[model samples]
Structure formats: C-alpha cells, structure tokens
Target: MLMGSCKSLKKVNTVSIRTTKPRKISPEAQNLYKRLQETTKKGYAFGHQDATAYGIGWKNDGTLFKTDVHEITGQHPAVHGFDIGHLELEWEYNLDTVPFALIQDQIKKIHQKGGIVTVSWHASNPISGEDSWNRRGKPIKKLLPGRRLHRTYKTWLATIASFFNDIKDDQGRPIPIIFRPFHEMNKPWFWWGKGKCSADEYKMLWRETVDLLTHEFSVDQLLFAYSPDAFDNREAYLEYYPGDDVVDILGMDLYQHWTAKSFSKNLNDGLKVIAQLGKEKQKLYALTESGLEKVRISDWWTKVIDQQLAHSGITWALFWRNARKSHHFVSYPGHKSATDFMHLAQKDYVLFLDDIVPIEVSSEAQ
Candidate 1:
C-alpha cells in the first residue's frame, strides 16, 4: 500500500518530458522532413517547381468506394510518395459504410504506409449549412444560415471534436490533421462560400467556426487552412483573404490540362499574389490542389508549378486525381479533354511538406 501510494505521489510530482515519453516520428513525416532539406538550399531561393521534388499525396473519397483498398492506395501512378494525404468525407465518397469514429483507424492505415492525413471538413455547402456540416450527413439548403437550425452547427461540431478527440499518431501524439474547411470559398457556389454568405458574413462564420472548434470543442489538433479556387484575376484572392491570424496556408485547385495559356495565366497570377502575400503576411503558399486532365498528357503536371519554384513564396503542390485514368478528377464533370493529348513525361513539382508545420502544441489550446 505504501509503495503504490508513493508511486502515485511521484507521478503527480514528476515533470513529463518528451525524452521520457516516447516520440515516435512517422516514417512519412521523417522522409518528408528529409526531402524538404534535400529539395532546397538552406536559404530561401525557390527551385524550378518540379512536382516530384517536394512531396506527393492523394485524396481518398473515404467510403470504401473501392472495396479493395489495396487497389487504390499506392497503386495510382500519379501519386508516388511523401505528399500530404487526405481522407476526405463527402456524400459522394465513403462516410456511408464507416462512421467518423472509424476514420482514425483508416488514417492509421495511411500513416502506417507513410503519409500524412488531411482531414476534409467541408465548411458550409448548399446541401449542408454550417450547423448541419458535421460528418453525420448534409442538411437541407432551407435550414441554413440563421435560426435554430444554425445552432445545430455547434452540436455537430462538438460531435466531430469528440470523434477526433482521441486520435493519435503511431507515437500516441495527436495526428496532425490539416483541417481544410470552406476550401475554394472564392468559387461563388459552395455553401460556406461566396454565393451563400456575404464577405462579412463569411468572415463572421469563419471566426465563429474557428471559435467554436478551437474554443468550445477543444479541437486543438486541427491545423486551420483556407484554400481558394485558382482565380482568373488576383481580385478573387483578396476577396476571400481571412487575414493573417486565421489562415495557416494559401492554396488553389487547378488543372494544367485546361488550355495551356489560360491555365498558365491563372497559376502565375496566383503565384504573384502568393509572393506578395508571403512578403507582407509572412505565410507559406502552395498549390494545395492541382492535376492534369488526361493521364498520358502534358508537362503541366510540373511545368505550371515548378516554373515559380525558385521564388520564396510557393512551397508544395498536390495533384487532384490518382494516376488511374477512370477516377480522373482532372477537370470536373463535362469538361472533356481533347483526344490524342500531348503528354509531358518528365514532370517536376514540389510538395512543400517542410514549409508550414501543423502544430507545436500551441500553448495547449484554450
């Protein structure tokens, strides 16, 4: 009895250290950090943005869309290694068979294979409002914005926090899930985006959502991100800017297969904006979402991005679809590619995993 009591008392008085507590770094993270150094100089001169240079990863539509998970993961040729991973939850994807609770198990699967998980948390969408946007299911359009239905946002958010609350990496530390919400808000349509709410409303929603998750739910594990769609002009970028405090990284979703000139223009415009933003705000920039429409065609897979790699602002770029031809998400629905497409085989692009880290136990949240 005295030994047990003494041990318990010692536990209460002892200061915990990372040395005593095992710090198991995931192999994916280990390689990613290694690649970060290998791919760049010690100083900040960006390189010719080769897609393969930095990091490579893919987004899995979580539901078990492919019953044979092995067939999908690592089998795709476009995604090779060390890119950040995403276990996205959309009505079109997995969330049907497995509940949100089981997501960590699958994330573990990805991590075991050496990859980081980017948790896809849709902000407000037409089918689901903020209040109704948790992993449960989408809400009706009419029930969004203001009123009791909106309050459901808190309930659902709490549910999500409780769900991810216990998730840990291989080392038992919380998995560094980059929670990207309201991505591409500049795209006027999506619920939590331009069409549904005014800029002020959007900012308020963001602030409120961050407050709810960061404060109320105690989701200290999340790395808050804002990814806007690639813009034709730089104005759209400014339109959705959530300011310095809220956004962690700047990114865009684009397809190099779209028309070489136009696509190049948009991406360059984005790079310029990022350069300016990075200079002023001190933030890291990335082509968060990217892809070529056709599997066998074009250097766009690398040309568009690495062209600006030598610049200090841009860090990483992750392709949209896997190497598989059928599951190609290159150009959304109805946007077909021309037959006999030209392919750029020696693609080089960077996946800047080393640029912005997710967290460092930021003062233990609130």
Candidate 2:
C-alpha cells in the first residue's frame, strides 16, 4: 500500500509519508514507524490500552467484552496497551495484573489481526521495594551504574528482556512492541522522576536500561519511547531527555489540567514542541497517555481531544485503561459520552484496527 517518489513525496496506504530509516529499531518496528509517520499526517490511529480484557463496565471478570467496540463504533482500536510490571516481578496474573503467557497470546493476536501493541512498565522501586510512586529518596541512583542495587536491577531487566524475547507470531518472527518505560519522568510522583534524579543521572539510567535490553540481552524487536509529563515549553520537555540514539519515539502524557480554554492552549503548546523536536530528530511522536476521569465533559472526545489531535501531528493517542466504573477514560455502552466517543472513532482521519494493513510474517521464520 506504499507508493510515490521522493520528488513528488512518498505515500503509504494512500497517505503522504515522512518516514526515516530506523537505525536501532527492528525491521518490524521500522515498518510500523514508517506507517505511523505517514498516518499521523493523513490519519490518526485510535489506541486504548487493555481494551479487551477490561473496561469501565468490566474488570477482568469472567465475561470479556465481545464486539463492544463494533457495537459502539463499528470498529476495534488500532492499538492495544498492556503492562509487564508485575510479570517482571514474577507476580501471579489477575484482573489488574498480566501474566507473561497471557501477554504473549494477546500480542500475537494483535499482530495477526492487523493491530498495534504498546507496552508500559510500572516497575517498583528496587531499593524500597515499594510501588513505582515510592519517593523515599534517590531510589533511581541505586539502579544506575555502580550503585548498590545495580545487580538486582540488571536481573530485573533480564526478566523483562526475556518477556520481550518471548513474544512471537505464528511464523516465529518476533513481534514489535513500542516499549515505553519510566514514563512521565518529568513528573515528581514517580521514583524515576525529576525530583528523584538529576538530568545526567536520568539519562544514564535510560541509556543503561536500553543497553542492557538491546545489547547485553540481545532483544531487538523493540522501539524505545521516551515520554514525559506535560510541559509548558521545549526546554522543560527536553530537560532530562536521554538522547536521540536511545529513543525512537518522542511521546508525551498529558491529562486534563485546566479549563477548556487553557487546557487546549497548554496541550497544543506542548505538542508543538514535541512535533517540531520529533521532526528535527526524525523521530515518531505520540500522545502516549491521555483522558479525563469519568469523561465528564459531554463533547470531550471531539472538542477537547480531536481538536488538539487535528494539528498536533502525533502518530497515535492512547487513552488510559478503563479500570472500573468510578475511574475510566473511554466511554462504555450507554454512557453519556458514548455517542461522542463513537463520533471521534468514526472521523475520516481516525484509523482503527480495520483501517490498518495487516502484518505479514514469513513462514520460514516459524
């Protein structure tokens, strides 16, 4: 579905392209990256992390959501989000947690069915053994080079690297994943955030993690994403950036933080910085995580979300999981915003699972 020439501009899936050859990413990732670059300008894909196993009306209950996306909007999300934190720690799989076995199955299905997969890690603090938000003191330093917990951290990476390695398709070729770690690093809530580590220290931590996963562990079917919280300007966004070599995707996580007027302005301003910087560095950009709790605003999907996306040039925007009734991002069937959400889903520029081209894996790889 890719066509055109350099002089007239390249086209993929009938859309104009602006893709760069990836140096460190896998061929599968490179393929998706190119499509995303072209798709953002021509159309934006809708992503909802953990859309099948759970949602607002459900929570890993025995009954799974069946054709609900089609029931609500006649399509499935283009991207599915999953987490491997608990799996890395060897925890049992449950409603709120994921198991390595189940994760691989889910990813394999996504690839086979012509959808994308993005994974995030909410790793616990190695030092304190607390949750990701444990801000006891400089926990990140322990995980860096020559630190007290460095060995343990390496073991942890080995576990994660194994999971990444284990994900394979029917043809046996490794499936590509948009691996986002230490997300919202600019925020102070997480242990790896600005308040817990220096800019240079954070960069080292990021590089070390990538090095361990890519080189030491020899896991290659991954695209690294460096994402931070919302910022007012480019300086703040790039303050703790690792570097161009270690990052393939420039992503931002922003939630509703102001009145309609100021929220849109702040979001657009931050997006402008990311979009411009991503272009300069020849990297893909995405709204890694977004949405208002409960989706109170009736037209939030179209007016608030889609309006900013219209000009942001982001490859995709993924709303957080629909955990339960009280805390949710996407509207379920019968919700007040259900109709509006479908409207956002049905936009001409909005691409869902049915809109994307299916991935083809060679039988030799099996």
Candidate 3:
C-alpha cells in the first residue's frame, strides 16, 4: 500500500535526488534479502559514540575532510571499546567523484578494523553539496525549507540500499550497514524538530521511511537506530521514541557536563534507565553518543563505563576523541580517552566482549 504524504513539500519522504532516473533491485538479490530478513537479526550498541558537531580540521580550520577522519578513527575507539563507528552521509562518495562505491570501501575498512559504520540522515537537508556525505554538510534548513516543488524524500532510501548491496562481507554477504536517520529526535535543535511534529506525524515519517527502505528498497541488512539525546527523565526520553518495533537499536547521546552534581546525576540516571530498558526488551544497548566536556583523568574513563556496564543488561561503550583536555568529547575525566573504556569491559559486563560479531549484536541489540 502507498503510504500517505503531507499536503505540501512538508511530506515526510521528500528529498532532492541527484538523478531523475530510478534504479532496480535484481530478482536474485531481492530473493536473498527476503530470505535474509527471516534471520536478518536486530543489532544493538552499548556505549556507542557519534562524530557529529565535532570540528577538527587542524588548528580549527574546519577543513577536517581528511585529517580529522583519520584522527577520529585512530584515537576515538582506541580509547573506548566501541563496536560501531558512525559518520554523516553526503551526496558524493568521497573526495573524488567516485560515487557511492568508494564510500562502501571505507565502511568495509571500519568493519575490518572491528567496527561497523553508520551514516546519518536528517529530514531538512536536501541539497547535494561538495562534501562526500551529508548533503555537502549544509544544515537541513538551508538545504531545504518550508516545503519545495518536490515534496517527497523517498529516493534516498533507494540510493542507500543500493550502496549497501554493492558492499559485501568476506562470505559475500552484503555488508550490513547501520543507518541512523533523524538522530537526537528529542532535541529541538534540528530543523526537523524545532519542537514541532506531533507524535503521529513523526511516526508516519518514521514508518514511511522504514517501509520504503526495508520493504520497497529491499535493504534487509540495514539496522535502524533510534537515538535521543540524554533525557532529563524517562518521560522526556519516551517523548520522541519511535516505539520498539520500528527501532532495532535503542541508544542515547550524552556527555559529561562541566558541573559535578548536575553531570553526575544525568549520567547515573541515564545509565539506570538504559539498564532497565535493555532488560525489559532483552535488547542490546549503548550510550550511543558520549564524551567529556572538561573532566580528564584516566581512571574517570573506566569508572564511568564500568559503572554503567556493571548493570544487569549493559554492553560495550565507545568513547570519543583521543586528545587531552579540549578533545575530551567522548572520553571521561579519569579515562584518558575513549579507548580507556575498553579496559573496564572485563570488570563491567564481562559478557559484552561476550559475542563480538555483528550477528550476535544484531540478535541481542534487538
């Protein structure tokens, strides 16, 4: 059945495509996906981290295109024990006009290094820019606003699904890509947000996106993650939640505030809620987005994640940034950096490093 669309360009699936031509999924691939979905598995993350909003172009030039990617790759997870690496998406593949093929190779590199890659999407950004991913890095409002001539963004789903198929694993299985669209849903800062979108409206968009991506596009290997910023409380967290079935992975983005009392409470409360939710759903979980703003001490790292993982249903943690002081984005005070979180695995869950494969995470994270 065709999903409903908004009267104007405000329609949930609107997007500015690079080409007017449409693509098709081969019959064999379609059959493979249908069979795969049966055992496709739902993946989850524990203590994951996002690289958005981080400016690292040497001396703050913000041209971080090449330099920052390498730096982030080397340091962030090394300090943290992350199983996933999340990046933003763009109209082009990479620095060159290699299309989406090169991007798939890069994702495989991340996976070869023991982490799956994720590309993010926002509702507002529609214009294709010079950047390799994420509409050339333009804010969604600037790229698209107030509805346009074309009111649907459905084509993007097809584009990404095709990219996923082009990339495969050692066994020839398509590289399972984790696509996180419209993240930080509860945060009002995003253009799709701005404190708008009724629950039904949001759900409609989410469901439509999923239906087109999974059923229509046949990207069965993709994992959908619903990530919200740290909540003030559970009620705030559930406000933008897309519900359990629509989401394969449930995670949150949080940070270490400079303040002692406030940050501590936020961290503790957030972890407590994470544990509860993971157990309730029997899902794999993560502190999806995290880093320290100011605090910096080696022990601070292990303690923070260890405490959280020490809980009943917690899994791995991914810290961000490898630099000291200012670069404490994903690292904690005592943890030294994101890599520091890994050491605590033995002490925390002891079982998270438990099942180290994507298949296991997919099954458990669900």
Q: Which regions of candidate 2 deviate over 4 angstroms?
A: 1-24, 59-68, 358-366
Model 3 per-residue lDDT tens digits across residues 1-366:
011122222333444221111223333333323322321132223323233223233232223222232342332221112111121243443222223444555455545544445455543344542232333332333322233412335445555557667677676767655556776766666544535445444554565566566667666666566678778777776766655555655667776766545665777887677667756765545555666664364555456545544543433344454343455454332334535544543342232212233232222212
Per-prediction CA RMSD (Å): 12.8, 8.2, 9.1
The weakest ten consecutive residues by lDDT in model 2 span 1-10
Which candidate number would show the highest TM-score if scored against the true structure? Answer: 2
State, as a TM-score between 0 and 1, how close model 3 is to the true structure. Answer: 0.61
Distance from true location, Cα of 317 in model 3, Å: 2.6
Ranking by TM-score: 2, 3, 1
lDDT of 3: 0.46
Q: Give the poorly placed runs of model 1, Cα more than 4 Å off.
A: 1-102, 109-114, 123-146, 232-235, 296-298, 302-313, 329-366
Query: lDDT, candidate 2, residue 89?
Result: 67
By the TM-score metric, which is better: model 1 or model 2?
2
For candidate 1, the per-residue lDDT at 69 reads: 16
Better candidate number, 1 or 2, judged by lDDT: 2
For all predicted structures, in order, the TM-scores are 0.60, 0.88, 0.61
